[model samples]
Target chain A: TQLLEQSPQFLSIQEGENLTVYCNSSSVFSSLQWYRQEPGEGPVLLVTVVTGGEVKKLKRLTFQFGDARKDSSLHITAAQPGDTGLYLCAGTQTGANNLFFGTGTRLTVIP
Target chain B: DAGITQSPRHKVTETGTPVTLRCHQTENHRYMYWYRQDPGHGLRLIHYSYGVKDTDKGEVSDGYSVSRSKTEDFLLTLESATSSQTSVYFCAISELDNTEAFFGQGTRLTVV
Candidate 1:
């Protein structure tokens, strides 16, 4: 099993604060994806990083894949109250489409 | 918003009873997956179907079974429900195995 571990299981920050969430794994993956889920809703895809050491930005969110494809990080600049939700990192193995999801990071941005 | 829907949005059943959840898709995607979400665990894949009548087990498939008879429908069954099986279930679809998946709203199951 490819285990993905996420640090800072929970984060509470003020609006406009900057924060980063990390996902680490010992097994390498071909691609990694970030998803955001709110209460009573399914997870929504944020970004997918395929190449190693790649970075993608979506508005205030910046996602980066590790050089070895075994880790990833998501950084939010000037977080807003609407950013309060659960962030999950999922990795797809080199030859598989089944995604392994990390434990998750619950972020609460107080306005 | 990929036109995915799950039936019985909320269900409550006694342990040992059989329960089935249905997923319907309008996009005619070839891949369909069943997942269960708990508090600490993000989401566990129960089963997945590559095509009609072609299914495979996932990481967490022991207690669950799935069947897809038509192109647009996938059903997940819990042969004998248990309290531990109480969780929110989500169904997702994708055109390709490695593509972005579209998820249904989800079904909340409660096994007493």
Candidate 2:
């Protein structure tokens, strides 16, 4: 059973378009993280959100943590071909050492 | 770039055969994890180690076992390979429980 669920299992968009990916769960978490992975490589950490209702921006990418700490979202503005890859969300429950991951979203940005 | 290496990047084995995957880290991180990635399941934890000789089962540990005899090495073993176990396996290391984790390139395993 997957603790977290992500929306839009796959996405494809043209260059300069926008897209958003969502990760949701019933259980609250102490922290949430987003990762991006390309083909044949390991997933790399993109950002971490610790507080509820907090939003962080990284150039063209924006990440937001839900107020209840049970959900998160990643939005990319003006998607580029280079942004094509898999996006995964992970969370650690309060007082728990184990990390749980979502189903994942595979994004493809066409030029 | 976190000094993590997974041996036998790709392997193919027959059903019921035993296989072992090695994950070595030079960072000396205290936490190590093994995860398997499949089509719809995404990434599921197989096993994890918190310290030398300390290991625990994860959500999908039915067909997998792990050993951490040393501080820098974590090993994942399949007592009997099965087709359902075929997937890409990843190894990750972290300094703390909730902090950022560094992952290995991943090993592709096939059970025929």
Candidate 3:
């Protein structure tokens, strides 16, 4: 069973548009990370969030950890064609070493 | 990009045959993991190793076994291949918990 769930399994948008993807779980997490995967390649790490309600920005990409530590969100502003890929969220629960990955969101940005 | 490499990027085998996938890392990271990706199921952990000769089973361990005889190498074996096992397998390595994981390009396996 998948411990984490992600919303908007698929998204398609034009260039300069905005989009948000969500990852949620019932179990609390100690830390959560975001990754982006392109075709024929492995997922690359984007950012890691450790604090609840804390937000981090990577250029036009913004990531936020839920205040309850059971959810997270990723927002991309001015989406570009280069932003098209699969977005994944992984979390490590307290006292656990195995990383539980969430269902992925595939984003397609058309130019 | 993190000096992690997976061999046999693509493979096709018949059912009931045995296959092994190799994951090699030059970074000497302590943690290595094997994951299989399928539609809707996302990425499911098959097995993982924390050090040489120290390994553990993950969520989907059926018909799968792993060996880590050396720090730089982790191997996953399928005793007998099946059509249900066909999926893209990924290798990930990390030096510590709560840190970034470096993944290999992934191996596309097909069982016919």
Each candidate's DockQ: 0.66, 0.82, 0.80
Q: What DockQ results for candidate 1? A: 0.66
**What CAPRI grade goes to candidate 1?**
medium
- Best-fitting candidate, measured by TM-score? 3
Model 1: CA > 4 A from native: none
**CA lDDT, every model vs. true structure:** 0.93, 0.94, 0.94
Give the per-residue lDDT of model 1 (tens digit) for B14-101. Answer: 9999999999999999999999998888888999999999999998898899999999999999999999999999999989895787
Task: Name the TM-score of candidate 3.
Answer: 0.98
Candidate 1: clashing residue pairs, number? 0
Better of 1 and 2 by DockQ: 2
Worst-scoring 10-residue span by lDDT in model 2 chain B:
B96-105
* First chain of candidate 1, TM-score: 0.96
How would you class the docking of model 3?
medium
lDDT of 3 by residue, A55-99 (tens): 999999999999999999999999999999999999998877688
Off by over 4 Å in 3: none
Candidate 3 C-alpha error for residue A41, in Å: 0.6
